[model samples]
Target: MFPPLCCDSGVDQASRRRHHQSRKMAMLSFWRDGLERQLAAVTAAMDTLQRQIDRDAQSDS
Candidate 1:
């Protein structure tokens, strides 16, 4: 999911900075979680591959 593009109505630049930082954090939250899930899946796949390779090597010995 993408974060909404919002316009800041604050007259002060500091408030605008804070608002954008909050928005960026919200956007990254989804991506951070997603990457963690993907990493877990890749790790599981590697483990499975390693096990299969080990089995094959044992059979060949």
Candidate 2:
């Protein structure tokens, strides 16, 4: 009889899982940073538009 061949050992599987989780966390962190940057840009634009509107209203008065 022949012994069964396995793809990965227990240690190897655990290491791979840890590596996958780390990569996933890194990706999530990157996306979170990108979203935060976009939000900041949008907020700044809105503030600028509000200031302009206020100026225009004051001039009209």
Candidate 3:
């Protein structure tokens, strides 16, 4: 949850900026990790399909 915005509060703006930046970085890292996992799965599937295709071609020849 985001902190409530106040009109006359004394919260340090620098600290708020740093907090937001850290959250953004964390989100980027999480997405990057998820993308890497998806890429690996796709690569593995492609390799399997290639092998299957090769076997079928050899059998037909």
Using TM-score as the measure, the top candidate is 2
Tell me the TM-score of each prediction against the true structure.
0.66, 0.77, 0.76
For model 2, state the Cα shift of residue 33 in Å. Answer: 0.8
The candidate maximizing lDDT is 3
Instruction: Mark the 10 consecutive residues where model 2 has the least summed lDDT.
Output: 1-10
| Local accuracy of candidate 1 as per-residue lDDT tens digits, 1-61 | 3433766565477776776798889889989999999999999999999999999999999
Task: After superposing candidate 3 on the true structure, give the runs of residues whose Cα lies further than 4 Å from its correct spot.
Answer: 1-10
User: What is the C-alpha local distance difference test score of each model?
Assistant: 0.84, 0.83, 0.86
Clashes of each: 0, 0, 0
TM-score of 2: 0.77
lDDT string, candidate 2, 1-61, tens digits: 2222545665577777677688889999999999999999999999999999999999999
Better of 1 and 3 by TM-score: 3
lDDT of 3 at 2: 65
Error of 2 at 59 (Å): 0.9
Where does candidate 1 stray beyond 4 Å?
1-11
